[model samples]
Target: MAAFRIGEAAQLLGVSADTVRRWVDGGRLPAARDEHGHRVITGTDLAAFARSLAESPSLAGSSARNRLRGIVTAIVKDRVMAQVDIQAGPYRVVSLMSREAVDEMDLRVGSLAVAVIKSTAVVVEKP
Candidate 1:
């Protein structure tokens, strides 16, 4: 039964506050006012909306279920290995790979990339 303010919902959804306001105004997102007259969205509603927004098809032929589209923010490389950082919405994904693979993919700062994640274990916490 957790609730989030408009700003918090926007941050969680990786959108501007104004955009979230518009969604509420346009009836695309359901919201209610708190005692202080601040608009709040329930965590359940937000999760449904997030799922709807993620309905788009992922990369063709990719089996990974988690895909985060983002821009490359940094790249640190040594003779053998490289670290690539991608800013995907409100999340930052970091990957360590071989320098040869980096060169083969030509990944660089400002490059658009998707972080495909497939794991058996994931950690979730309540805030």
Candidate 2:
């Protein structure tokens, strides 16, 4: 059974360690003291809590499983294409699309957008 310390859990969840501590303190997330007397979250419990946090009613019909809601941080447009940057939680998602599509969507800095990612091959790495 794998367990994560508060700092590790926070890094995985893209939040600060203090936020994880608060969640544990407020009973939003379950934790147990390890043998060393430090709080730790079981991997199963952490997965459930992460799922709960990711549920979004607005994205109910999306076919893509990976959806990140974020504000548009930057947009660069040329004559034919545009590049958009979004800060979603602790992740930065970038997209390049046709300028016509960008104009039709009225995408601009500070606009709210959702990045729907559908990838067949994704590489996962551990540090």
Candidate 3:
């Protein structure tokens, strides 16, 4: 792919040229100057930076704040509470002693369950 100029990159990212320059200066976005002092943006560098930004804390926190969806596999109802086995991902998460919440969700085995974990923390990983 052809490299974009600073202005073009700013337009692509929906930001001002100065913001893009700031990112470059902050090492979020990497750029170099030609002999004529023109800022040249590399497509490779842009892609790498985009991947990094996607895994950034801001984006992750916003995503967690967005929503968390899952399913209920089992529910252990007690005298006053219930333990719910929720399958949210590659793992199963359990929420114990939440009778009212379980009832509010109408939770049962094989029922769809959605858990909203609002957090400012961001989790990052590599495959």
Candidate 4:
């Protein structure tokens, strides 16, 4: 249950903060308050919502990309830019990001990563 501020959630959800607020007010979403009493959503709730999206029969076209969460497992520096290997559950994705990001993050075998999938892109893929 990791809490996120409304603005952070809005950024993740790709919506306006006001829209998130309305969902909270309308009970279409849920939020909690900290000791300081600010509205917040938790990572647990977000994961649950992702699971719900997977379970809903109406969204049969959903893509498995939505289920990804990864960790930066390794980096291979080359004559060119470095390559990053992110382990997303049973899947390993090797991708190239800016060397700056790798340096700034100090990305190593244990560095955390969140593989983002914008909702509109959820779709069917060939089995």
Model 2 reaches what TM-score against the true structure? Answer: 0.77
Worst 10 residues of 1 by lDDT: 56-65
Q: Candidate 1: where are CA atoms >4 Å away?
A: none
Which lDDT tens digits does candidate 2 get at residues 51-96? 9988868667876778877999999999999999999988999999
Q: Write the per-residue lDDT of candidate 4 for residues 1-127, one digit (tens) a residue.
A: 5788888877666557898898788987789898899999888886565455458564466553454567888888765578988887557877777777778878887888865454564467764
TM-score of each: 0.84, 0.77, 0.41, 0.42
Judge candidate 3 at residue 59 and give its lDDT. Answer: 53
Instruction: Give candidate 3's whole-model lDDT.
Output: 0.73
The candidate that wins on TM-score is 1
CA lDDT, every model vs. true structure: 0.93, 0.94, 0.73, 0.73
- The C-alpha stretches of model 4 lying farther than 4 A from their native spots are 51-127
| Candidate 2 ranges beyond 4 A from true positions | 16-18
- Structure candidate 3, residue pairs in collision: none
- Model 3 TM: 0.41
